[model samples]
Target chain A: MSEIATPVQPQRAQRYGLRNYLQMYAVAARQAVIEQLQYPAANMMFMVHILIEPVIYLVVWSSVANSQGGAIGGYTAAEFAGYYIIWTLVRQFNLAIGPQGFHWRIKEGRLAAELLRPVHPLLPDLGYYLGYKIPQTIYWLPMGILLWLLFKPEINPVAWQIAAFPVVLMLAFFVRFFFMWLLGLVCFWTERVDALFELYFAAELLFSGRLVPLEVMPVWAQNVANFLPFQWTFYFPIEVLLGRLDLPEFWPGVLAQLAWIAGGYTLVRLIWKLAVKRFTAVGS
Target chain B: MLRPLKLFGLFARISILNEVQYRANFFMQVLQSSLSLGTGLIVLNVVYSYTDNLGGWSQAELLAVYGVFVLMSGLIGSLVLPNMWAFMEDVREGRLDFTLTKPEDSQVLISVRVVAIWRLVDVLLGIVVLGVAIGRMGLEASWWLAFAFAATLIMGMILLYCVLLLASILSFWFVRVWELMEMMQSIFQAGRWPVGIYPDWLRLGLTYLIPVAFAVTVPAEALTGRLTPELLAGTFVFTLVALFVTRRLWMFGLRNYSGASA
Candidate 1:
């Protein structure tokens, strides 16, 4: 019974630390990249699906601007083009695991297996969605170039704005990621999530400047956007890259994005504690 | 023709029966449609706030366009799209053998198999919007206008069916056509605005490549009293040609389809 003199006693309680989590994210991200890259055709179609939304907005807004004597709420037709073109890229960045995916995971019993893991389910999702950016950006390049050529969009970013673009873009991803994960957690409570998800997306569509730049919206709507995180995900990044924001405005936007990310992360953590407690695995 | 109609009726009844068992989905569809409609109205209002006209379309005219877009979306969603998806799935999973072996025509069988009955909520909603739009425009409904609207709408549906069927036919040769289907649907979003607003290149693509212009805009134009006789004539010819070409392609694709197994 001498514990058979364990061949090599497991190292004294190796704490699952940050380095371990980082390694886990790297592995998960790499897996996501490899998995997404294999479906070139499928990914291209998805890119087209994503691209059409912004393109419609660009076309419609550009037409409105042109029709309205070259500008509306400070965006010229060319600027609208520029905003939504870069929107294509921002969209690629901020794409996250939607609540529908969570509902699917839960209903399919995949969450049961996932709960067996030591880390939160949200961590791997963050990594996977982060890695999803790789193929998405790669697919975005040709489409971006084609859009640029087609629309002849006029984006004028200065040196610092260009440099700050990537940072804000990544921050935007974090903000959206946590919020989306938080929304996904509601699946733990109710299976009837479609109406809720639709409402969330509709809100995002209006407030996020995914439809049009916030400035172009009515003053009241723009004021409403001020309190919502939706704009940080689309409007802030696109404006930053479109060079519409000054440094002072830029810094505050970035700070607000960080604030949302922190708030979303905290909410997810608190809700997740209750959500996990309510979970009853119906499958092995 | 009568036989196909009977077959379609029988399949539609079965689909309706199957769907009624899930009554909650109807409410969900109603909520989703209303939300989208609300967002669409918001977008229109936002756009109208800045300009009285969008690409030569008055706000009321554009509302009519939006109504047609929703109506056509309901038509496709409730009738055409689900069938195409099922057909593609059957092809991918080799279940299409069951259809081909049936006594009825394969095309008719595939076309009328799945009716998403709840999606008709959008249809009713679209009609309501169209009614409001017509009231806003105060268009005197002439008998000719009514005839033209009905005629163009039927043609539009046929043209869309042909185009979508043409797309689904590719599932025979290509395993992953859902992406293509999704892309087409997104492109259809362009029809929400008058195809007139899009750049020339896109206008041509939407009109010819996808026929969304004929499907949504032309009927909308009819309702708005903007449909020219020549455009209506041209649409009629194009619809005929599309149906013929789609029929031929379906036959060709069926021959090429080896099925998932021998």
Candidate 2:
């Protein structure tokens, strides 16, 4: 027991100090990447969803466009191809849609162990999520290029468009993770989040331009989508890459995404506090 | 076969009892069913707003297809999927050995152990939608058409069950293939739209490989009277073949499982 010293005080320091906390997350994230790399086949199989979804939508939307005499919402079949291919990239980079270990943590009573740890329970998981994406993004590059070739998306994005992407994409990922994280935390207050999550996903599906481009949506729906955070996750990055956003739209969009991220951080922090008060270790 | 039904009945009763204890889950299931049906309708509405038809399917016709899709999904989710997923779990944890040792037929036992009875909400919603769509479209009703729809629908369900059983049986060798299951689901979801929308290769893959086209779309075709005799006969033959193959694979997996456990 003496040999198994618990480093409680240092953990307290690390928990309070933002720099140390972030640094620890980096280390944990690095470890997660290594662990994920060990199962290359698993990663490859998993990545198929990221690749296939866009292809499916691309095929579906293209058929609709062709049926409509080759254009809808100012996007031709080729442009749709470009949009989905770019959408795939946006999605892969901002893979915040799927439940990321948070559900399992609560369900399995692993959160009790996490709570015992000196660090905030959420950061390590969040770090692991972000870390998992690093290698996933690396693997996605060749796949993205292959899709790029196959679809032959026609947009000639400039260097600035390319450069601005990582910033926007990172914010998208951050906001999405936090948003989903807040949703996942609802498990603490409810017996099940499954149905609630379905409704949440329905909202996301319509607004995120995952099923259809918001531009093609009716004016009223498009206006409503503009105010929602869902569009910032998938549609904004892809649309921006396609040079769809005008100059006035650009700064405001980025500002909105950042504000949402800040909003998510605050909301999650509040939820976590309430959640901890309710959390019980019954199933570990 | 009678014995299998009895065994299934017992398992299903226990599951229904388990589910009914939680009244909230009943309401939740209804909400989720509505949510999914709403998602499909909204997607249909949005696409139809831009185009008159999707792959030669008008909105109401596609809505009919969606109804069958939902109905079939409920059938699978209620009985087949939860059991299969549980079977995979048992395979991973070596609890499957206990299943094999039971006096009852292990295949039947493992396949009917879990039932999400709440999925009836989806089934109810699906039939209502199908009824409304048929009424709205006025697509020439008849008893023979109903018979054809039932036959094709049963064939589709059997084929889906076979495919799911086969996939789950693979867990004997490769335990963590939940990703593959997720992939299958995404592919299965493509069945919502008419297979005609897909390119030739994809259409063939959905037809012959996953059999999703047969599982959902062909039944919809039968209901709409678009299904020909050749298609009907082909689906029947294919279902028989799949059932035979998956049954053999299940036996092989049991052998592997018991051998490893022994």
Expressed as tens digits, the lDDT of each residue in A1-284 for candidate 2 is 12332322213534267787889889888997899888776677777756777777888888888887889899888888888888877777676535435677766767667777788766786788778788888778888888777767777577777788788988889879889888888887775777888988898888888766788777877888877889999888888888777768888989999999999999988877777777666642
Cα deviation of B60 in candidate 1 (Å)?
A: 1.0
Q: Which stretches of candidate 2 lie over 4 Å from their true place?
A: A1-19, A97-100, B259-262
The docking category that best describes candidate 1 is: medium
Give the per-residue lDDT digits (tens) of candidate 1, residues A1-284. Answer: 22222122112344688899899899999999999888899889999999989989898899888987999898888888899999999999999998999999988778877876666778898888888899899999999999999988888899999999999999999999999999999998998888889999999999999999988888888888988999999999999889878988987888899899999999998998888877776633
Best by TM-score: 1
DockQ for every prediction shown: 0.68, 0.65
**What DockQ would candidate 1 receive versus the native complex?**
0.68
For lDDT, the strongest prediction is 1
iRMSD of all candidate structures:
1.1, 1.4
